[model samples]
Target: MSEPIRVVVTGAAGQIAYSLLYIIANGEVFGKDQKLVLTLLDIPPMMGVLEGVVMELHDCAFPLLTEVIPTADPAVAFKDVSAAFLVGAMPRREGMERKDLLSANVKIFKVQGEALNNHAKKDVKVLVVGNPANTNALICSHFAPSIPKENFTAMTRLDQNRARAQIAQRLGTDISNVKNLIIWGNHSATQYPDAANGTANGKPVTDLVEASYLQSDFVTTVQKRGAAVIAARKMSSAMSAAKAAADHIRDWWHGTESGRFVSMGVVSDGSYGIPKDIVFSFPVEIKNKQWKIVQGLKLDSFARSKLDITTKELLEEKEEAMAVCNGN
Candidate 1:
């Protein structure tokens, strides 16, 4: 067998971690043939829960899982890791302002970024799954100057997958028939789910779904699906979020099959007029271990307006974070 690939996951005591570790242990994310050594990181107070998770991992007796290490220190957790998933963060509590939430998460990501830069392997790819993921990813990328900005991405695949599944169900077709869906801008409520460029079995999605529904209801449904899930389950989203993380890393490290571009919140390079240095989701195609923004697709006026709104919101949050860091 080849040497084990080291993966570090932050927030190891959280619900998503519970859902994610099982898949990783079974080698579903990386592949069945590859062996894995997982380093699970959590806060000191959460170490007990992480320990419980470790015990469960052992119980599974997965052949592909070589070892599981749980720790409270980012340095220890990220040491020599091939990939780091930044899933831990200060969630937005009730009565908290957006600025306050961003400030708290910024501190958490900053330390993780420095640790990853100092201790992780040279090729570490980071996926930020925490709330306000795009801003948090930007903070981490800024702190880890040594790591390429493109290597730090926030999860938007969940939204993309949700859009595809919804479209598939509406059309009474399998998900395989859905293609070219794009989740643009931030991963939050302001995200634009573009079916304008999407297709179902080579036919434009807009052709199947009514234009009125597409213009109003479909976009709202995709953007607010998380809230709906929470309302129904009376719990936070865990399983689907974990699956999205896996899908994202798998496609990135492996490759997106022909004719598909995954949506990811990567640091913007002023593509599509988005401001530079902000982590914004775009329709991206991955090849040869790098992601390039999918260009030349004309956005209708409505899509353009929606993208602007989301990008502006992200920029404002980033500015507030910078002001706080500067003690303004």
Candidate 2:
């Protein structure tokens, strides 16, 4: 077997980590034969919990998992790492302002970003999964100036999956039949779940579903699915989020197959008039181990308006982070 690829995951003791570790250990994310050295990182206080999790990982006895190291130091965790999952962050408290939340996460991401630049492998691919993921990814990418901007991304696959599932249910079809769904712009509520390009067994989704419902109710449901899950389970989503993260990395490193595209929040290259440097989700086709924005799709007035709104929100987030850093 070839030497294992090293992967670093922050928030090692968090619920999402609990769901992610086992899958990664079994080579579900990388590939069945690919080996991995997993570094689990957390704050000092959570080290004991992380260690316990590491013990469970050992119990699984996955042959592809070469090693599991739990640490509190970013530099130690990221050392020679090939891929990074930035899952740790200060979530918004009950009454925290947006600026306060941004300030708190900036501190965490800044440290991790610097560690990535100083210690991680030359080809580190980073996925920011924590809340406010796009901006958080942008911060990390900015700090690691040497790393290609395209290597940094944030998760929107969850939203894409949610949209697919919702469309499947509404059309009374199996989820497997759904394809070409896209979640554009921010991963937040303003995200545009475009059914315009979606297909259910080779037919346009809009052709089979009510256009009004698709434009209004379906869009709302997809964007609000996270909150609905939290309300239904009485806890934040972990397993599904972890699965989505895994799917993201899997598709990214392996490649997306023909006739399918996934949504990922990558650093924009001024596509569709979105500002450069703002990380926004787009319909993307991944091949040759890289993502290319799907171009030449004509958006109707509704889709265009929704995309504009979400892209504007992402820009505002970038501005807010910049202002906080500037103490404005």
Candidate 3:
């Protein structure tokens, strides 16, 4: 067996990590053969809660899990870890302004980024799951000067999975049959769920669904599904988000099959005319743990308009995040 690799999850006592930790420890990700040391990090106040989580992890007796560490220190949690799920952040309280929320998260990510840079393995892969995730990822990448920009990414797979499920439901087919669905730009409501090139069992989704529905209802549904979930459940999504995070890291670690396009929030290299340096969701193919944006898909005028809207929103977010960084 290979040496045990360390993995860390910030906000480990939270609802999403509650589900995600089991998925990782059960060897659903990193393969059944791989050994792992799981590190769980939460704020000081949550340390007692984290100890309970650690106790539960021990109760599971996962063969692949070699050890578990629960802590409130970023240095200890990040030390030599190969991968990190940055799930902790300041939640937007009621009546909080957008700028204030961004500012608060910027501070959190900046400190964590420095911790990652100083303590984590050089090849560490970091996923920012916190809100305003795209910009948080950007700020994290900025502080981690030693790590490659590609190593830092935000979670947008939840949005992609939601879009795929909606399309599959509409067409009355298995969700597994949906392929090549792209989520463009920000992970927020401004995201563009592009179904033009998507397929269900080798049939174009556009051909199977009405154009009017795809243009109006399908787009709006995917964009607003998070809000809809909160209205119904009175809590933000947890299980699905955790599942998406697992799917994302699994595909990224194991590599995607030929012709599969998974959506990820990666650093934009001006792909499809998106501004450089912002984290944007693009349909990408992965191999050897590296992601390359899917190219040459023709975009209609309507798609272009949607893309522009999201791009504008991301640029605004970047400005607000940067202002906080500069002030501090």
Candidate 4:
């Protein structure tokens, strides 16, 4: 059997991590036969709560899970880790300004990033899932100077999955049939759920559904689905967020289908004219442990207009996050 690799999860006592840890231990994110040790992190005061969560993981008796280590020290939790999930962040309270929220989380991510850079292997894949994730990832990457920028990602797979589900339901087809639905730009509502290249069972979505719905309703629905869930459930999305995080990591590790793209927020190389140095979600696929942007998709004028809006917002977010990180 291959030696076990260590995987780190922040916010170990939080709702999303509660849903995600079981999936990881069950070999959903990492495959069966690969052994794993879960390194979990939370605040010192939350250690008691984290101990109970660890007990539940042990109760499952997953053969592949060799150990569960919970710690409040960032250095101890991140040491020698292969992959890390930055899931904990300051949630926006009622009446909190966007700048204030960004500033608060920037402080948290900076410390985590430094710890990872100092302790984890240089090749660790870092996925940032907290709100304003793209910018949070950018700030984290900035602090983790030893790790390559390309290894840092923000979760936009949730948006991609939501778009695919909406398309599949509208067409009354299985979700498996939808491929490569583009989520251009930030993960927020400004994201463009472009069905321009996606297909339903090898048929172009345009051929299956009305262009009006794809252009207007489909885009808006995928963008606002998060808020709609909160309204209906009285809580922000937990299960779906956890599921998407699983899909994001699984696809990134296992590879996507041939001739298909998925949305991931990776560092910009000026693709699609998005500004360089900011982490922006683009259509991409992973191969040989690396993710490269999908190239050569032509955008119509309407698509370009929406991309402009989101990219502008991301650039603004980048400015705010960087300022906080630099203590400007």
Candidate 5:
């Protein structure tokens, strides 16, 4: 067999990682033919808890999971890894502002970014799944200059999945039937779940759902789904978040079907008039393992306004992250 691919996951003891690691071991992320070595990292205080998580991983006896390394050091965790998931960050506590959350997580990502730059493979793909995800991604990418800028991204896939689910439910079709939908700008409540150019089973989405609903309930529901999940369960959304991250990486690595462009939070190149410095979500297609932003979609006035709100929020978050990262 070929050498096992090294994968590093931060917050391995956290709920989302707990939900994700088993599926990845089952060859859900990497193909069944490939072997994997999982390197798990968390805070030093969480080491004992991480030990039990490692024990659980061993108990599963997955054939593809040949080795498991648990550590409190980012350098140790990220060394030579092919992909690293920056999933561990401080959650937004009650009464904390978005700026406060972004500031708090900045240091964590900065340290991880430096470790990844020094120890991880230059081609490693990094995904930031923590709260204030898009701006946290921008901060990480800023610190990891050795890694390819395009390889660093944040999780907007969860927002996209929610949007597709709402679309499919309303149209009475499978979620797979919803194609080409876009989640524009940040991952927060200001995000716009756009179906203007999307399709339902090869037909224009407008033909299947009313525009009034698309711009009203569908947009609001998809944007606020994360908070809704939290309110209903009294905990953050874990399983669905894990599933979305899995799907995001799978499609990125294996490529999506023709005519489908999923939403990904990538560094902006001023596309759709978003600022170039912040991480922003855009509709993109993956080919040759490279994600290329979809171009030439015309956004009418309403779409423009909603996108503006989210991008502005991202820009503000970027400012706060920079302040914390630079020790201001």
Candidate 6:
């Protein structure tokens, strides 16, 4: 067997990590043949909770899971890891403003970024699953100067999965039939769930679904699905979020199929008129653990307007996050 792959998950005691850890341990993200050393990180007060999580991991007796290291230290958690899920961040309180939430998360990500730069392996793949994730990813990448920008990404996969599911539901087809659906810009309400170029089982999705529904309900529904879940369950989404995170890392670690693309929030290189350096969601193809943004998809006026709104929102978010990160 090859050397064990070191994987780290922050917020290990949280519900999302509860679901995510088992998935990783069972070799759902990485291959079943590959051995893994799992590091579970949380706050000092949550160390007790993390211990329980570690116990559960051991109880699972996964053949691929070689070791479990639970700690509160980012330095310890990040050390020489090949893959990292940055799932920990301050949650938005009932009365907190968006700026306040961004400020809190920026502080957390900045420290993690420094830890990644100092302790993690040079080739570590970092996924920021925390809220304000796109901007948080940008902040994390900012402080991790030694790590390549391409190594860091934010989770827009959940948004992509939601969009695809809605498309499948509308067409009365299996979710597997939805292809090339992408979430553009931020992972927030302003995101564009572009189905214009998508297909359902090789048939054009737009041709199957009414444009009126796509223009109204379909777009709005996916954008606000998280809120709806919270409203219905009295808590935020956990299972679906964890599953999407798993699919994301799995696809990235392996590769996407030919002519198939998925949404990932990556640092922009000015593709499709999006401003450079912002972590924006774009349709991308993955191979060799690298993502290339899909290009030349014609965006009509409506799509362009939707993209601009989300782009503007992300720019505003970046401004706020950077100010807090710089201690302004």
Which window of ten consecutive residues has the lowest lDDT sum in model 6? 319-328
Candidate 6, residue 296: lDDT: 97
Runs in model 6 lying further than 4 Å from the true structure: none
Tens digits of per-residue lDDT for model 4, 1-328: 5799999999889999999999999998989988999999999989999999999999999999999999999999999999888898898899999899999988889999999999999989899999889988998899999899998999999999999999989888899999989898898999999998989999998889898998999999999999999999999998999998888888888888779888999999999888899888999978877888999998999999999999999999988888887784
| Reference-based TM-score, model 6 | 0.99
Question: Whole-model lDDT, candidate 6?
Answer: 0.93
- How well does each candidate superpose onto the true structure, as a TM-score? 0.97, 0.98, 0.99, 0.98, 0.97, 0.99
Q: Tell me the tens digit of each residue's lDDT in model 1 across 1-328.
A: 7789999999999999889888777887778888999999999999988889999999999999999999998889999998888889998877999999988987898899899889988778899999899989988887888888889999999999999998999999999999989988998999999989899988999889998887788889999999999899987789999999998888888878777898999988888888898999998888877888999888888989999899889989899877766662
Candidate 2 per-residue lDDT over residues 244-322, each given as its tens digit: 9998999999999897999999999988878888999998999877899999877999998998899888888888887
Candidate 6, residues 1-328: lDDT per residue as tens digits? Answer: 6789899999999999999998999989999888999998899999888888989999999999999999989999999999999999999899999999998898899889999999999999999999989999999999999999998999999999999999888778999889999899998999999899999989988899998988889899999999999999999999999999998899999999999999999999999999999999999999999989999998999999999999999999999988897883
Clash number for candidate 1? 0
Looking at model 4, residue 307 earns an lDDT score of 93
Steric clash pairs (candidate 1):
none
Which ranges of candidate 5 are over 4 A from the true structure?
Answer: none
Off by over 4 Å in 3: none
Cα lDDT computed for each candidate against the true fold: 0.89, 0.90, 0.93, 0.91, 0.89, 0.93
Alpha-carbon runs more than 4 Å astray in model 4: none
In candidate 5, what are the lDDT values of residues 1-328, reduced to their tens digit? 6689999999889999999898888889878878999999999999999999999999999999999999998889999998888889989998988777877788788889899999999989888898788888888888899998899999999998888888888889998788888999988899899999988888999888988999898998998898899899988999998888888888887887887899989999988888887889999999878999999999999999998899888887887788787784
Clashing pairs in 2: none
Model 4 residue 104 CA deviation in Å: 0.4
Give the runs in model 2 whose Cα sits over 4 Å from its true position. Answer: none
Q: Which pairs, if any, clash in model 5? A: none
